[model samples]
Target: MRNNEMHEAGQGVLEDGHGRRFYYLRLSVTDACNFRCDYCLPEGYRARAGEAAPLSVAEAATAMRAFARLGTRKVRLSGGEPSLRADLPDIIAAARNTPGIRRVAVTSNGYKLPKVIDEWRRSGLDQLNISIDSLDAAEFARITGHDCLPRIRTGIDRALELGVQTKVNAVLLSDGATERLQQFLDWLRDTPVTLRFIELMQTGDNRDYFASNHLRGDTIERQLIESGWQLLPRAIDAGPAREYAHPDYRGSIGLITPYSRDFCQSCNRLRVSAQGKLHLCLFADAGLDLREEIRRGDVAALAERIQTLVGGKAASHYLQQGQTGATRNLSVIGG
Candidate 1:
């Protein structure tokens, strides 16, 4: 099907046998990152390999335009650290101008966000999701292998000051990090930033670390509710996180259980890596290469390939069966 035909056919709505609509696209702008988080990348992992072939800004814009033409209305720019790309604002602008696209967001580690929050807003960014695994100074350094918490906090404050919808993402590891959940929550009580707790997924080169850090969402929620905070439903879309709000709080809480429980039946997003591969599922070991094909000016073939991949997507991820190790690390693929 041609891109416009696919858009009119509503084939890109990506409804499964269960009638769930997949309309979101997560696009990774770069694979390079500055931080070496233990859970995301193994300790002492080589930061540089042979120079990797990343998609050019124009190529990324082409894929985004094609996705938009096929009914994708939401696109989130992600990366090993998306902010590292100097042309990030341009990418956001291109996606914003794409047909059928309604929202443009970015997920960053927040190390360099304080300086660019204003530019991001001016460039048509609708939202920002910052990854902050720990609030404590020393513990955060241990988790991210960097002393960037202060800068990250400043970036969050800047986002709030600029009136951007912001969310703080934290991953629950088996290192007893959940014990400090209340501390993080209390610190954010006065801010408008929502807190999201993510279960450590079994991916990348950190199998041993993930195996030790896997914490269930139910346990974390029960612990928080018992600590005198009320949890209320706050999910506005059909994404993985189950969001909740508390009485007398300025923000809310989001819990994502991709490993403990699979939400794949309602999975509505497609991931495009920095190398221009289309990943149907975050845990899938393989993906369809669209960069080369799209550059050849074959829009019809590209749309058909995407439809076939989505149709063949697995009902759920394999993490529940103790499976780990994807073809690429989370940084390269974009979570």
Candidate 2:
């Protein structure tokens, strides 16, 4: 039987005190990115002089094994930009080889995708999530501080050709969001990829930027619905996006409205930083150190530690209250 089917047949599951079960794990492979997106890292990524390196191949494997054994079926490798890792393919293979991990995915900026995507796919990458904030080349460059949108587009086409499940993420900004939406929808009329519009969130370092650029996701959601897009039911292991499909378009749209009411009620995923700390919520006040258990190489202890930590997860993130917790910036936790 397929590993996912076996997991569905009643294996152990990870549940928090609020009774939410986790089936997805977003693991950061590194905290460094090449992009200087305005909402994320406006000045680009700088390596900390005395910071410890990210998890080793064996350590990543151990963490994945523990989660898989506890009913986590999907593992997404994230980062400030995950593709920056020279050994990312090795990490992908390790996750794929885990006994109960049914899917291995990666979220990248697509800066190096054109060159290394084939290697990643061969290493068992089942899904790819690329960030393409704007469809206009000039505006894209303005936002991402890179004039390589053409190259990123080429890599996306390559991913499509490889039959990799592809999704594109765009941050909704008050400036020109309407125009960007029109461009995205026009492109989606033919492209079969899923385009996800994420609401601009307020991180500790991005307060002023957030205040200036934040756009409510519901406005876009309402517009799509009015245009006859049908809301689709979420999959058992889906992320927090509410997806919609249009009869005349090949692509689908997903809205990630974190500030919307009850947004956290469907939370089914957890994050672990590249530094080996567990974050119960993206905006939580602190992270629990899991590197110690990983260093001991004790799977049982690691699993127990994870479960104990998860049980203390708060019912919801206080984003509406403008509380951003320990997330000084998105890059720190691979948001």
Candidate 3:
């Protein structure tokens, strides 16, 4: 977009009282996930009775346009599994078609990438983030209740071949972490992908799981530095991960340490739920509904509501206070 248009669109609402400017949006396409991950949905996803259907392709596109007008440069399509949505390619095209949006990304469980990744790339996908919690086949099955590691690996390879920027997200657990980290590092030595180790976060429904599996990423960061892995400078639009690189390794490592002090100070993203609710924070008490404006096809009203709601965003989430407000599980908002 032209500088003048960006100036007008940003009319100062995208920046909060804390002076943070949001340039990224994580938009969930659905809350229903197929994987029965131990940390997220141990019993698997069951649709909530009477819950509104997820935003349609047009609705999602409208919301993206509104955010694009408000200076959002990147949009990441997320879900319990975004690939589960049949119109995912349309959503990807929508983001790519937006004037101000420069990148379109998706986060999925990689269950269907082998079959649909090529189509996704043809539809204008620029980046991919797939969940691969464990490299060990048996452990992967134990964690995700799916014995499809080989298939997922094939999908990752295809993504690499397609020249898409790909990243793997792994939830770091305390159980045998040393061995797990070794496996990850060994794989990264020859794989040209970014492997991110996300510290297990506490949620409303995972107190016991959190207490048992949560691992501090700070220790991992220190280890990386000691082992000659150089920390890379974060870009302005980067996500929460602190990335590192090593000369001997083909791929890189990223540590997402949400519990660290001042973790939210550099926040630069907002979330929109599948039902068209603007979430100020992943752990916010509730979201501001924008379905009405979206349904009316009123971009101005949608943007206005988003700006108004964003102005009241808290300085930081209260996860440090041992409170997970509205998020009952990671799948709820595609965390």
RMSD (Å) per prediction: 3.2, 2.1, 1.7
Stretches of candidate 3 off by over 4 Å are 1-13
Q: Mind sharing the TM-score for model 1? A: 0.90
Question: What TM-score, computed on C-alpha atoms, does each candidate reach?
Answer: 0.90, 0.97, 0.97
| Clash totals in order | 2, 0, 0
Q: Of the candidates shown, which would achieve the greatest lDDT relative to the real structure?
A: 2
lDDT values for all models: 0.76, 0.91, 0.90
Name the TM-score of candidate 2.
Answer: 0.97
Tens digits of per-residue lDDT for model 2 on 1-335?
Answer: 79654643226689999999999999999999999999988988888799878999899988887787678889999998988889999999999888778889999999999999999999999999999999999999999999999999999999999999999999999999889999999999999899999999999889999999999999999999999999999987888999999999999999999999999999999999998999999999998999999888887688878988999999989999998999988888778
- Which of candidates 2 and 3 is the stronger one according to lDDT? 2
Give lDDT tens digits, candidate 1, residues 91-206: 98987776677788899989898888889998889889998888888988987888989988898888888888898888887676655676777786888877889887777576
Model 2 C-alpha lDDT versus the unseen true structure? 0.91
Model 3 lDDT-worst window of ten: 4-13
Clashes of 2: 0
Pairs in clash, predicted candidate 3: none
Instruction: Give per-residue CA lDDT, model 3, range 176-213, as digits (tens).
Output: 88998999999999999999999898988889999988
